[model samples]
Target: MMTQMMDILGPIMVITAIGFLLGRSSIGFETRTLSTVVILVATPALIFNTLTSLDITPETIGTMSSAALLCIAISGALGLLVLVMARSSVRSFLPPIMLPNSGNMGLPLVLLAFGPEGLQLGVAYFFVVSVVQHSVGLSIYAGGLQLATIARQPLLYSVAAVLLVTWTDMPVPNIVMVTTEMLSGMMIPAMLLLLGTSLATLKVTDLRPALLIAVSRLGLGILSAVFVIAFLDLDGLTAGVVFLLATMPTAIVNYVYAERFQHNPRQVAGSVVTSTLVTFVCLPLLVWTALGISERGSGADAQLSQAMTRTETSLGATYTND
Candidate 1:
């Protein structure tokens, strides 16, 4: 399982290498602009397409929602811990710490790594994380909340697009779907290119803090999974989904938020860059090691026994009459 995970991480590492090297070569100017377009237009379409394609039953929706909230809760806890440890106020420390780059980097990779299941989990991550970041993250980072900003968000567009697909069997306009797809297809590579551009701008001395941030996320992530996932009875693809999303580095949204609200945008940006780079290796490891097929815990064994008993039942009297 570990070897298989390493195989999957190889492409990610290659892509990341290209990103970093391109930036290092100072040829990433065009790539940065292309990345902006991908984030503002294409990536959202891809996410909407994936989310709408899902057959979100009430049970599945509940599970997704629950998992997302759990993730948000953990994120909040971690951010607060960091702020306190640094002797920084919650109002100044959280926005940079809480939100992760789920959209620009996480969505596309998740689709590739874990397929539809992984994509769905990414969408779930987007929903919960976005809501929490906009609300709780903003309040903490700014020392106040703003309801109007939430009320006026463009995110409703995604929700509308998703519902349009899910509730109807009608065919989508060919041109529209194709355009959306083209945009969506551009998202991953463009994001990597932009990341490359960013990396090129940083000096070696500037990267020490980034390294520390990455190690912090990875180490804390390991601890969080040890307790939360084992207690939750999630297994197989679901377990993989949870761990993959949970282990993602501080999101790019934090950078955006920091422009307006955070005390140290540089630190936030550093964390985002560092964590994302490391997650390429760490994400696959976490999924395969912590989330793959596993025996359900103690109580689950009883449930399995009951299910087997039910499966064994039959209307036939067998040969007892003989």
Candidate 2:
């Protein structure tokens, strides 16, 4: 089990480590742009496809979605508490502090490690966090968002997907499913490669603050989620996924917002790299323990867990793409 996990985790961490290195280098901007493109386009398609393609059951989706929402609520609240206690206001720092680096880095890494199961969990995380980031976090960050910013959305599409499944005897189209799957499959590795390109340009010393802030934020978020997961008695995968997503580094969307609004991009960037590096170690351990890996698990269980994990990646991609 440890060996299998190490295999999955090692490459993911290595890519990010490489990314960090590249990001500090002279070629950083060009690499960052390409990474952004992959995340904005290829990754979203992967998410949509995986989310839609899996044999999605109401119970499964419900459990996963609920976990995600719970994590977001917890993370968001924690961030606010930090802001408040530090005598900071949401207007100044809450949004960047609250939002995790879920896209570009999180999406790609989840795809490679958790497969379909990870994909599903990642999408749920994205949906809930996206909302929190835009609504509560955004309101705090921007003073107020224009109705136009809020209006541009696919809220109804998510609603219709659920309703379509509930209201009638219909199936998702095969062609659409295949197309999404193909495109989504390309999302992770491509993004990682681009991340590598980005990292090749940056130096390590300049990014220490980003790491420090990310570690602090992620540490608090994970501690909060761990308490909730224990209180709720979630399933192994559910519990692990919840903790994993909660531990996601500060997300890029917040950084962009920070950049646009004249918030501190340095803090946001530091958190992204720091949280990411920490997540690689923390997540696998959390999963191993939460999933009963040492107790309810044996060799067979690892294999079974592996299968379940794959569903998260594959189905999540479908659901997101569709």
Candidate 3:
């Protein structure tokens, strides 16, 4: 278990660690430019490529969508409850607790642990979360409902294009597919690198609030994931993918939003860093549990197949005698 865990998560950490070291060194780079490239170029290409190329069935989309929405809704509600009890601003706390680093951490982790199908499902969940983060999460910070920003994001258009192409069964040229795949390939490493850079730049002033929010994010997320999987009857790879995604830490975008809106950026930054640190503990456990479930599920399937084969053999012998 330990070896498997390290093998799966080690590469992710190594890449991020490189970025972290660079971030801390005299070496400097424009984080905004990197973020823009990721958000506008790499991410759109990745989403477009995955949505168009993967065998994303209605069942798969529906299950992943349900899990994403349910997880966010449950986490947001719990965060709101805590904020109200503590007399804290929802704007300052909820987004950090509700939103997660699905892009940076969730996507790559799922891809590594569960393969392409898992990556496809992870993207579906990520899309749902991104849409909500831009619209609903933005509104929470701005103190008003905002949908225009969501409409303006390049990702929205990319998703639309992919859906149109998929629905029409358009034959994309090999060059286009290859180009998009090449661009998409950069997203995971860039995202992890960006995560490390973001963490390095962040300064934590309010450790108490940061720790509280971090713990709440992970705790609420796990509970919500359990309910979502059970309610949706999600099993096997889908269940595991959704659960790990649910447990992802505060998104880097949350800090961006917090800084933009002046919603306690320091505290938000602290939460982002602290929650990510906690993932070093929580994520492995989630991965281990998910793999165990997959193993048991396969065993049951094999047993069922054997039973059906024995029944067919019995019936065949009876017919031959007749």
Give the clash count for each candidate: 4, 60, 0
What CA root-mean-square deviation does each model show from the true structure?
A: 11.4, 8.6, 11.1
Candidate 1's displacement at residue 133, Å, is 3.5
Candidate 3: deviation at residue 107, Å? 0.7
Give the poorly placed runs of model 3, Cα more than 4 Å off.
298-322
Using alpha carbons, what is the TM-score of model 1? 0.74
Top candidate on TM-score is 3
* Candidate 3, pairs of clashing residues: none
Model 2 lDDT vs. the true structure?
0.57
TM-score result, candidate 3: 0.89
Return the lDDT, model 3, position 295.
49
lDDT of 3 at 176: 79
TM-score, every prediction: 0.74, 0.73, 0.89
Q: Write the per-residue lDDT of candidate 3 for residues 182-298, one digit (tens) a residue.
A: 999999999988988877889888888887788788778776876787677666787778878888898888888888889998888898998888776556666775565444543
Each prediction's whole-model lDDT (CA):
0.59, 0.57, 0.81
lDDT of 2 by residue, 1-322 (tens): 8786777667766766676666666753465466555545555455456556665565666665676666666666776776677664456455555566565566655555566676676666665566566566656556776566655444425534644653454677788768767766666666565555433432233354554455555655565555556555554555555655665666655655665677665555445555555554456654454344223322344444554455345434543673
lDDT of 1 at 131: 66
